[model samples]
Target: MTLLFLHLSRSDYKNFLNFMTELSYQCNITLHQSDIFSFLKEETYDLAIIDAFNPCSFLVIEKLGIPFIAFCPGLFINAGRVGIPGPLSYVPEYKSSLTDRMDFFGRLKNTLAFMVSSVIVMKMDALFDQVIDEHFPAGSRPTIADLHLKPELWIYNVDFSIEFSRPLLPNVQWIGGLLTKPAKPVTPELEDFIAESGESGFIVVTLGSMISSLPVEEFLKEMNDGFAKMPQKVIWRYDRSDWPEELNVAHNVQLVDWLSQNDLLGRVFVKHAFGVGTGVPNLSLNHKAFTIEQAKHWCYQTWKKVAPQLSYMSGVRDWVDQRK
Candidate 1:
């Protein structure tokens, strides 16, 4: 029997340390005193599923001696942990901002970052050592690497289409879109608005869940000016309650307090006149937006070129069948 629980203190967000530091701080918590572990000892779970990013979970589950599977919700799992090639050559390091395609300097920077992050992850994983020492006998206590390197499976909740081509072990499963639901027409107002847009299908603009508002007032003005010039109707998810009253609202753009982002995205079937633009928000509170035409032309089209060759949900069924 297995249970997966990840609790992050709301207080952690108050200071908002660097992403790695925050994860490390979370790992600093000891599970030896938790009542949940006492209950875990009594119950019988067939398998444990745990957050791959959290080493403490691995240790707790390992203490139960039940086979466990892990999931890395984000991209950076160094497959090298299992003796597979997670070479710094192609696989990006944490927060490197460099894609798989790299030049000499890019590779050098990535290598440095990879080394640094590996140390950080190692330290984070080690934070649970006291718990392990307390629970397991000194002679039998497993090292951090032993606990980390032996999960039965690693489910990467990642879009394969977006990832750089790289080797994966048999135990590593690439499954995606698990959280995506069928687009719902629950919002009557949005439904009516989309219906009125007709053949010129609407574009959905959102900075996503964490970002409720842009930092600067000028950013709003620029976005307003830019959206006004667009041909297609835009439903931009912004915090309308916090919107500046002095700004002129674009007629083409609909500002809402919040949007059903997945519903909006899944429902829309529109020919995009503009290519994709990504503002790499590196876990920072402030986000800067920019529009560069050359980058838009280069970045989005290359994915289309490579996507056809890739397989979606490959090896997952076989992996499951073998495990069963």
Candidate 2:
């Protein structure tokens, strides 16, 4: 959590500049060599399973001289690092918000996004120059991008069944929904709340933890009023303690700090989230979009077919043994 550097300049590059600034100041700055790094140099390791989004981990690879697996925890975070063969014509830019079914203008925007994102990534990588120079000899210094490509395998936390179909590299693999648990029945309290709505099913609202609370009181009032009009009971992930004491709670809405997303994924789903894998396509086998049952079938099939073979091919089973 300690910051070693925090420097940023206003630029005409817009979002790319903001991204580079936030990344450098908030994340990478603290990765500078310390006693922990000294301890790392003295220890021998079999393999490094890296959180690819944290480019700082590249320093660990440099120090350890160990084989690695580039593990991307989010579906599209720093997606281009592994070079997964996303053609701009069909594959939308990471954060450009364009769909696979793009018109000419959408294609142009996606292309531009790709170019801007590339420049941003390169600049962000270069920010490690100071640390790299101080830690290693000039002849031995490696480009951050080079270290990224050196990973023996790349694993993304994504389900291809609910994503746009794209060609993938041989080293790349998908293992999303691996952590998903079977849906459990809703508790009696939640059941009673939904039953009060008669035939109208409940609406689940989770604004994500990042920007959960509304700062503007008026905006909160307006939003609260809008939710009040809905006949369906609302199960919102809003901390009750954070609620404004001045405002009245919506009669139809049930405020909660958390809810089981897996337990409630049935009937009809209106998914709203800001992420690459979750959006777009929500697609599956044969390009059929929004067929949950078929998607589940294909996802299960992929798991059954790929899991056994992948362990053998990637040597994950042996690697795990080495770790143990």
Candidate 3:
């Protein structure tokens, strides 16, 4: 059987490649770096693993006629108002924003419209012919549909021991942090810096791959000030040319062009923290305010919501260690 990995970013590609290599199952593997749509026309895949963030994957699945898996960082369920629960869900509505964005009156109108549309699409005579028993099993059967509707599946990635509060579907697996192995070794300068910082621990700041080069000098300055007050060492992952001079002299700070984030965060001393523009809170109140922003654009408002906190470092560390 041929297993095709689709729609992965560069970092994700690295992780997926490593995981596939380690797996005992023998299958033909092909990697496509471009968008799933472009790749779909050229080839066919037996099984597809897709990032849920890319909604277009759903369309691809319909074309490919394969049982595929969807992966997401977090599933936003409607809690109260605009608030979403911490856990992820596989609800189709959640995947689409049709209902989530409708106003109160508009929601009511849309609900009626949806019911009418459903009746037309699913004919009354067809209901009786449908085999419900085949889809919904007696007792308990591990099914994606069941897990998608219910958040209790408690599934998580294997490489990282990041557990879910609820149960998860048997088929919905996690192999997130497992792909890449450790790098050679930390340089002497970096090693010495970590050693000199005593027991207060260190802080590691990275904004993932896409926006690592964006100019955020003012925001970085604020972060530098925040770190300056804390009694911890700071390791800022920044491009050397973009490094701000004001932050260079601090004895407590170590600036590098790039560091192995997964490895560094695994270390005992490194704490993870991210900075956002002052306008973060306001943006949360209005989700549609920045629709035109590019995927790589770093809006302080959006970053604040998705950004990891320093306290989450322990949880992330524990997750990684468990994978080992």
Candidate 4:
């Protein structure tokens, strides 16, 4: 049997490759670099794992006669369908300010509901007959829409072991948090910064890859000022060269052009961290802090969101565990 892994972007492809290597599966696994649907047309596989961020993969896999799994950052079943009027709706507009975006709880709730629903609809559309045979009893028949609307199909969360409390088909499983590889090693100077921070837990601030191009000076200043009052060291990852020198020289801060996030998050003394960037929420902090307690709470919540699957070895490990 062979496993085909379809990835959307270069970074996602790189991350998936790292994950497959660590899984050490002995099957014939091919990494297709281009558009996944185009690649699917040329090959056949026993099973496929697709990144949920890539909706194109869903449309492609639906036509391919193979067992498939879809992975996303958060809930999967309702993802693309819930908030969206239909599958083809345009992407929602988000505010430039992180504070405004995060504070908009209604949007967040709707988006999450949509994601969860999308996952269910996608799986039912893909595995309708198969799931019915194994999960549903002999006398019952389920329609495609019924399968899609059924709340029991969601199988996995980022942490796979925790089963959804509601009724669900056995095939659905939570296997998030399986890709906890350490970030690539940093330069000696970056390593030294962590060392100098000493025993008090430090903070690592990054805005991930997609939104890193946003105005850095203003964002960095807000972060620097916020961390200055806290007792922890702050490690800021900025891509630009024009950072204000005064903040760079602060006793409690270290500013770098870039640093390996996986490596830094794995550090022992980095008790709290905040990230502001694209993709799913991982150590995210909105740019404004009205109070010290709020800042600390944000720091704590950010870690909590990403911390669950840090212990798993692979997506499959978490995936399998969720079945239990």
Give the winner by TM-score.
Answer: 2
Candidate 1 local lDDT, residue 274: 20
The best-first sequence of candidates by lDDT reads 2, 1, 4, 3
> Over the stretch 44-141, how does candidate 2's per-residue lDDT look in tens digits?
77787987766667666767778889877544445566666788899765545455678999998877777776766667777767667766677998
Off by over 4 Å in 2: 1-19, 26-29, 38-45, 73-80, 87-92, 95-113, 134-137, 209-212, 216-219, 267-324
lDDT of each: 0.56, 0.59, 0.39, 0.41
Task: Give per-model TM-scores.
Answer: 0.59, 0.66, 0.43, 0.44
Model 3, 99-184: lDDT tens digits are: 22346565554444434433422332132122222322465332222223333223223322222233344545455444456656
**TM-score ranking of the models:** 2, 1, 4, 3
- Report each candidate's C-alpha RMSD, comma-separated, in the order given: 12.3, 13.5, 15.7, 15.8
**Candidate 1: residue 318 Cα off by (Å):** 48
lDDT of 4 by residue, 26-47 (tens): 1111222236545776776777
**Candidate 3 — worst ten consecutive residues by lDDT sum?**
280-289
Better model by lDDT: candidate 1 vs candidate 3: 1
Ranking 2 against 4 by lDDT, winner: 2
Q: Please provide, for model 1 over 67-147, each residue's C-alpha lDDT reduced to its tens digit, 9 standing for 90 to 100.
A: 989877544344555455667787655445557687899999877776665655565555556666776787888876777
Instruction: Name the runs in model 3 displaced over 4 angstroms.
Output: 1-43, 75-170, 174-184, 199-201, 213-216, 244-249, 266-324
